[model samples]
Target: MKIYIITERARTITLEVADSTEIMHIKLQIMINEGTPIELQKIVFNEEELEENRTLKSYNIVNESTLYLFRLERQVGEADMTDERKVFETFENL
Candidate 1:
């Protein structure tokens, strides 16, 4: 089945999976493709968190199911870095 994954940054991505596939495997794929660490990834569907040991079938996940991906760690080079750069530039301009 094909599932839609929405990242913490609100980026949407598509993933092809099978009913027998485990949640951990999906996280592995996200780690490989999106560079998100498996330990930091939290996948949620229909307001419920998906367990790593469970299969897609266990969650009744069907084709086109939307999963929300959340990263527990702070993402580098994102808002934090940008804000720091802005502060540095402001100080430089003083």
Candidate 2:
């Protein structure tokens, strides 16, 4: 089960090795990559927020799932998001 991870803050990307479950693996991977512990981090997926205290295994995640990491891009504003979102939305509308 290859689980994907998105480092929202650092904009770093990596794959988290599957564990008996994705519990500790999630914590360890994020901690190692970002050098921050779960207790002091904010994790989100696909524009939805996630709790760090809980385990990922319980989230009903499946194999080969594509996860996204989002963060505030410095010197950028909501305009950037709206523009990109509009493009994607427009494409789908077409």
Residue pairs with backbone atoms closer than 3 Å in model 2 (clashes): none
Give the number of colliding residue pairs in candidate 1. Answer: 0
Worst 10 residues of 2 by lDDT: 69-78
lDDT of 1 by residue, 1-94 (tens): 8998999788988999998999999999999989887888999998999999999999999999999999886566544666799989999999
The stretch of ten residues in a row with the least summed lDDT in candidate 1 is: 73-82
What TM-score fits each model?
Answer: 0.75, 0.46
Task: Evaluate residue 2 in candidate 2 and report its C-alpha lDDT on the 0 to 100 scale.
Answer: 71
Clashes of 2: 0
Best by TM-score: 1
Residues 32-72 of candidate 2 have per-residue lDDT tens digits of 77665555445565565665555555565667655554343
Instruction: Candidate 2: list runs displaced more than 4 Å.
Output: 19-24, 46-48, 52-54, 68-94
